[model samples]
Target: MMAADETSARLTAVLDKVRALGPTLRERALEAERAGRHSDETIADIDATGAFEIGSPAEFGGYEFSVRQQLDVVTEVAKWDGSCGWTVWAGASTNWIPAGSGARVVEEVYKPEWVGPRVAGSSHFPASRGRAKRVEGGWQLSGGPWTFGSDALWAPFTNLGCIADDGEGPYLVGAQVPLGELRFLDDWHVAGMRATGSVSCKLAADELFVPDHRCVDFRDITGGNLDNGLKGSLWQAPSLGWSFSLMAGMSIGIAQGALERFLERSAGRPIRGTTYKNQLEAPLTHLMLAEFHSKVQSATLMTRANAEETDRLGVLAAAGTPADPDYMQRFSARVLVETAYAAKWCAEAVELLQRNSGSTAIMDFEPIQRAWRDARVVTLHGALNLEALSENYGRLMAGVQPHNFAGITTLDRFAPTAPNKAV
Candidate 1:
């Protein structure tokens, strides 16, 4: 293993690359989405930078960097374009789960390099259904159209969920399928995150075959027994917390971009009527800008602190110390909900800025308008909903314990504060 200093330096280098590419990538994102084309070049640049490898296990050719580093990369990329950061962050995050019984299948999908572990599954509302039958060597997966699997264009590996029929229960099983094995449907036309190329995909259930090694019992990870190094490292410290923290970072970045555009446009052009010289001189504009800056700063600080805490926890976990499961779950849920709140905060900031900026801000191609749409869409992600998440955390805190999505149900109480409030 490399020295800690070396690892830090490597992470810094990756962040620098992401920062340098921010402007170009952001521009590319706008162009690609506007032109209705795939973001092939942007995706390639991310892959080449090894940004995705930050979350993989070192044993599997990854940097195994701290979760903070991962968030740093995602946040910086997000400053340029929300969809690019979202796509990269989502793909990287998915690899944290152990390969389980499907190790070989994962290996096959991620062969030669660990840069892109494509996960083409969608978490759209109203989940879809699948059929799984036990067969000789493995299981046969038959599924029609799965949304978001269209992202497989950039992913070498894909996951298809199906209902299992062992009579034990109906369970969702993830299988690693080569991109070549799936067909993409041209159905990902959307208002936001359009560049994600997240189209519907059709997998032939009858012809689909998964070997035992490529099939993992998703339940195994609930016990924390999978072989991915992150299970023992800081990356897995708060589990869900890291995802929430990253989401917060993305929201902050989007807000920051919107704020910058607001300031620039306000300086150049004033509202048509009764304004002193420029919009900047308008008291209302000044107040709204101040509020925007304050909230974005607050969100950015919370995101950073949350990521650092997660990193600390990961290091402790890697050292053979386990975090309190309940504490970790609450922490995770809190950060995710906080991220949504931050997105809402940013959306509110943008609304104030837009209202003051006049009719031109509503132009279809305006950056402020796009930022508004993106933030609105981001707030809808399951991870960021505050009320439900708080209830989950509250249940654990109140000792009314229940199984988290991971199936671990141990409660460890920690002080409650604002979502992503520094521990």
Candidate 2:
């Protein structure tokens, strides 16, 4: 078991490192967005932090910290720069899969470099077709076009969901394939988050081999077959909870960064014909700051509470006394929705500050402008799609069958098209 001091020290060290690199990373993100691609150095820094290692098992040299800590790291990084935080956090979150094909495949990817794994996934399953047919030694996979495969540039492995036409029913599967065998399409052109390097990719092999061990039936993960002991206690207690709570931290961090810039720019800057010496004394400015602070604090608390609950459940699950699957599902749904809502709130704060910051906020080279755009873009990620997630949570609360067990339908929608051509 890791001592309290050990965990605290580790978290602090990572946060410090992230903060130290924030300015450089922020600049790189802006450049990538403008240039339509990320630099190799930016990718290397992400790998070096071992931020991707947060989700792997300790046996594999990962910190294997609770979900809350992972969230915190992501949130904090996002504050410095949204795209980097998004890439890093998303990469780490992919490690949350149960120990089976998903975990094994990821482990295989990380085994060689230990520099963190690369991840690019989209919940929009219907948009692509990739499939694995049962075969000798390994399964054969073929498909084309998956979206949001961030971190694909350096990642040696990638995962795609497929469906098998089992005589009984359509069975869903997630296939892990070596990055070397896949083809990337240049399609990720957008106004924001261009640095994520998200593009369409095709995986075609005359029978790409996926060893049996690396193949995991999606049913197993959704069925809740994973059972571990240590995770429960660490995640259960409220005081010790808030590990996954870091996601909100990222939003807060972004808001904080913007707020700082606004303050610096607005202070002593007079509006024409105004009696006030500077914008700082403006009544509207005071109200904006107050609202921003209040919203940030509220979001932080909600994030903390959800993180605590997630931890508590982990402890229970680890103790061999897993919580009711339905309850767990509900909890997860709520947290996911709330986190997105918090992000929205944070984004609003940024917008407010930007609106009041005058023309300075729109300067392409200004970090405040970049932060605003990045937060706005990231809020649109399918994972953060608030309405769908809220409805999912409502179903759980009302004892209605969930649309998808994984809490995100983006992946499940692709099941039907997995066998034939890529969608």
Candidate 3:
């Protein structure tokens, strides 16, 4: 482990890197959005900051920054460009392969070192796309065109979902496969988050062979039952649950961006049909700004709360005591609820600002408009939707397991899996 001061210094450097890159990233935001992909320069700039390697193991030359640090950087980047933030999170997604059943394979994947390669993964509900047949040397993987294949264009290997061909006890399995084996569908067309390049792709069912070394039973990954090598490691912390905090951080940034733009654009502008020459002169505008400020402040508090909890749990995991199931549920639920609510708050805050700013601010090309769109789109993520999250948390309290979630038909639908212990 890094000494406390060293970790602080490294985190500060990374935060500074993102802060310095903000202007350039924001300058090129529209260009990346129109192209539906990050420019090579943009990706390189962010990667240079080590934002993508935040969760990597220390042995592999990774900084192994804490979850709080990861979310801090994520929030900072998203403030500049929404897609860039999502892509950075995707870049770090490989850090969570959950070492138990696939420990050897994961070790082999990172054997060469952890500097540049992009790692992408997919996990969808019900295992509808693929089949896994146990072969002599490994599993024969057939069928996939997995959705949510973020960073697919740059990633060399993508962990794909498949179901083992057991007669009565078929199980879900994950196999890391070469991106070349899959064909893309060019989908990801959305209102906001347009630059994410999150398109659907196809993998031939049963055509590709996955050696046993590259496979992990979804159950093992979910339960954090990895090899001894990772018993007391930060990587043992479940990655899926962190998705909430990741999204929460992004929400905080998007809201912050919107609020900044709102203040900049509103203060000097004249309000029509009013005696006031500028928005800042109006008592109502002062009230409006105060309320919006309060909203962002509250949302940011929740966002920081999620990040702190993640750090606490990570420390426990690193100390050889995995997080308790109930605590995980509360944290996970908080992530979903807080991120979604924060994103929604940001979306509405911008909408209110946009409305009060008069006709000129209504232009489609406006930055506040962009922030509004981005926040709205971010809140639409399956894991970040406020309604679904509230219901899930409520159901958890009512004794229904999240495994029985409406969209989830099976237990392994989500992985780096969590325990099914009573909530």
Candidate 4:
């Protein structure tokens, strides 16, 4: 891996490139939304800019940029279009699977180019369904359909979330299965973020061989502590910590876009039957706009602050510097909590923006309406479930079992990533 600064600069360059393509991406948004798949032209444009592999580590032609970078880039793209932003997130996030697998594994997946997998963090465990069986070199996997396989269609592989029964107890693990071995069910019709093309994926009794190296033991990679066998600063945050930051970026960007549309529409627009000439001149309008601005600004600040802390801790871990272990534990918990807050404020802001948008927002073609829907849908991601993460953080503070702390898949009803440490 090259020096961290060089890689981060390259990642930033690509993000800037993506931002420059906003007009093209914006033009393709409705088409992608209607098709429930990103347009080939949009995909090609994203590919040309290196946005798809932004999450890749230094080992494989990737930047492995910090949490703040990831979130910033995703948010920048989402500011113009949500579907494209989501596709970027899905492609970049899939690298997490290979990052945990190891360097060689990542090389194989993106060797010639950056075609990669569509990973689902949550799924019906293979062992739970009796579909994973011990084989000579490794385990053979077969399973029924699983829903919410986001960004699977364009990818050639699938990261199947599973629980491996080690006889003593079941361990949370992830299996990288070939896409050729899995069947994709075309059923992604939805109201918002329709461009994600998140549909159900199915695998029949056709068992596929998966080598031991392709499996990621969640406990081993928790707190973003990926053992890449290198001194370079890449892919080494407590497990999945960066993901929340990226989600926060998307949440905030969507709300900001909605606000922009609101402002544009309200410039000289008037309220019905009111003595006030324009919404901009009315006291209630001033209050509403101020409320939206405050909520979104606060969300952006908090999420970015979390990103900075994440970067500090990640850099320390990568350099083999001694970091305060207590801080790391509490940091991850707080990042999740902050991430949920960001999502909450984004949703609230969007809802208000849409409400004040008047009858025009109901025109189906209005950007604010779609932004409202997109914000709501993205916040529903298991990782961003506000109430659940808040409670988990509280439990962690009380020195109690903070749910999903590993032990069994059944331990936490809603944890998307395995805990960095056992409770």
What are the clash counts of all predictions, listed in order? 9, 26, 10, 6
Model 3 clash tally, residue pairs: 10
114-148, model 3: which lDDT tens digit per residue?
33435776764454487778889988887776788
Question: Per-residue lDDT of 24-90 in model 2, one digit per residue for the tens?
Answer: 8876766888766667777778666657666556655666667777777787677777777767766
The worst-scoring run of ten residues by lDDT in candidate 4 lies at 407-416
Q: Could you give candidate 1's per-residue lDDT for residues 1-423 as a string of tens digits? A: 557899999898988888777778766766777755445667778877777677665655677676677777777766677777677677666654434324454456445563354444442222445555778998777765766653476777666655565887565555666677778777767777676677777774346877765655545533345554224364346655655677677777777777777777878575676757777777877777788888787777777888888777767676876565545656665566567678788767767777777788787667777777777777776555667666766665665653334221222223333333222
Candidate 4: TM-score? Answer: 0.88
TM-score comparison, 1 vs 4, better candidate: 4
**Model 1 residue-pair collision total:** 9
What's the TM-score of every candidate structure?
A: 0.86, 0.85, 0.88, 0.88
Model 4 superposed RMSD (Cα): 4.1
Task: Give the alpha-carbon lDDT of every model.
Answer: 0.65, 0.65, 0.70, 0.70
Runs in model 4 lying further than 4 Å from the true structure:
1-12, 115-130, 223-231, 322-325, 404-423
TM-score of candidate 1 versus the correct structure, residues matched by position: 0.86
Q: For model 4, name the residue pairs that clash.
A: 222-239, 223-238, 223-239, 224-237, 224-238, 224-239
Candidate 2 ranges with C-alpha deviation above 4 Å: 102-107, 116-127, 204-207, 224-249, 395-423
